[model samples]
Target: MHETKMKPTINITRLQSTFDVSSSIGTTEKGGLTRLALTKEDVKIRDVFVEWLEEAGLAVKIDDLGNIYGRREGKKKEAGAVMIGSHLDTLPKGGRFDGILGVLSSLEVIRTLNDLNIETDRPIEIVNFTNEEGERFTPPMQGSGVITGNYDKEIIYKLKDKDGISFEQSLIDSGYLGDIKNRSSNVDYFIETHIEQGPFLEENQKDIGIVQGVKGTKRHRVQIKGKSSHSAFPNSHRKEALLAASEIVLTIDEVAKQFEDLSTSIGVFDVTPSVESITTEFVEFTFDARHIDNAIKDQAIRLIKEKINEVSIKRKVEIDFEETWDANGTYFSKEIMKSIEEAVESNGYSHQYITAPALHDAKFMTDITKTAMIFCPSKDGLSHCEEEYTSIEDIEKVTNVLLRTVISLANQN
Candidate 1:
């Protein structure tokens, strides 16, 4: 009988230093980063990641959507690589650890391979997906979405930032346009190390989270149209879009309360006839709903639509629902989930299998290949803000788990 061999372990200090280096790319006064997509911060951070990749002695490449890949060779050259990483882009005034942790942790993995001189049967690739924050762009996970054929290059070429700069222009500006390969199919398994971005682990007294599933999301641009009127003439005879919008917002809140696992919020809205003296003729608002179960998510969205119609009827307004983006729920493979569980146990760290309420690039990659995620706890359950954080000790714990899992996956046939 053949015996299973062990792989080399990663260095904790090196991983911590990698985290420091990336965090330094777009450092803000508030102890966070502001590396919005396609901005100068993005270029600076991409260059930093590329430099580290080269320093680790790995061959680095950039994809069409500006996704970065750093590869370390293995014993079997033809075998598919084991890819692990997250995004490098950050939201406006975002935390330091959210997406950066996964990228830096993967870098640490490659650095460990270089230090130990240990080669596996399959290569390992560290990926830094572009514009995962969706802050500058419309939908988040733009790079992964395009790579997985969710959207076409023409659409990518059309996407522009607030400054009216096209995404294609940004790609060219960043010097990333090249004949990049479709490395998605080349990956046999994918792993992401991330901060939990929630309080589940901390509340449960755990150090890490073995992600069981990621929530599917539906984003809607709901428009409530009503006749504009004078502010002093507050009567049923006069139609007001603001009132209709207020009622619809309340209805959305009510719809959210109907489910245990469902979540709903309005992130952005715009009103026409913008003045204190007059009522608005049109009101446009956004609806963001997420759920682990498809059935519940669908029902919740349906109920929101029903309420929107109700408000429109009561206020004599016209309502229209425009879908911005609706992505299906995603699940990680059992083998990879088990690897995370075992890694946590082997390291004596307490963990739990939790559902990710926030969406990620991993959700999009599920269509291309098997995906799994590891999470460290966020302090105060904060994310997408400058206050979002995970302690360095906690970061190291999750990176160690990621290292073990990646080494094991790289050795698989």
Candidate 2:
């Protein structure tokens, strides 16, 4: 059994105040946030966060990837720091709670430590990873990915946004470009507290989700080429690419239901001559499949392809299915997970274990160090929209859990 005592609560009012102020930066008319990574609004928030960190007597550092780390020294300055945080960048029209709350709650942990005059054996650091939403950046989690050495920094620097602004140029302009040597790669533990972004916890009537892992994601582009004819053409004589595409779409959806805890979605769809009179001669769409188990995910991929091939042959059309991106499923440290569970128990919050369907910075952090996540409930299983919400009480519960967990880990030799 662990031998640490815990009794600290977060100042909910203060956290709410900070969250409200941040909600205004890059806020949309629909009450959502659009603070893409390294934008002016993002810069404003970073400045505010740094100011708060300095006031709390923490040393702040920014890396070449624009990832921010604020360190509160411990009695043992040489010990690896316990890092806790999430991304702050928001998707276009994204709800304010998704990434913003995790970051602020982490800062709250540090503030509470100061308020109580508590000192630990290990240092504590709060991080704010950049470009987690990939709204402006083509791929999300670039900061975490680059730091983990999963992506080359040169390629990441060369990526251009829709406006032709290179990522490297944007970072330089944001005034956050820092030496790569400062990448706080010496973390002993990394923890993140985020809204569930789905209805799992709320639907189950649980207060906290001790996240076990993140689902692996795979993306594929399916391009279908077929003969084009007028809409009035005989149904028997036509080879419509749209028809084959529709069959594949239905096949994916139908197969998803056959497997438990699997999700398949089509986000992009393009067609040639999409008019009333002309038949679709060309069609392309992107498919995303996510599951925690690689074996099951691969099985699903195989089944989906088999069905797609059946459609291609039956429809007498050519189909090209090519994978564009993939991230393997990642599991958190069992030891860190146990630590979170202990915090949940001490806080007397109802909880359950879950696997996140969406990728997070924590997923990539696991590549470098032991990492875990705490999840508060999202209303109606909705996210990436202005309507996403989690109660202040829920935030309080998780932040308190984070505080207690940090204390325990920091006290460890």
127 Cα displacement, candidate 1 (Å): 0.7
lDDT against the true structure, per candidate, is 0.83, 0.90
Q: TM-scores of the models, in the given order?
A: 0.93, 0.98
lDDT of 2 by residue, 1-413 (tens): 22255477889999999899888888999899888899998999999888988998989899999999899998899998899988888988888999888899999989988888888889999889989888898788999889998889999999999999999999999999988988997789999999998888999999999999999999999999999998999988889999999999998998899889998999899998688899989999999999999888889999999998898888889999999999999999998889899899998899999999999999999889999999999989889999988889999999999998999998877
Clashes of each: 0, 1
**Model 2, residue pairs in steric clash:** 199-381
Predicted structure 1: lDDT: 0.83
lDDT score, candidate 2, position 75: 88
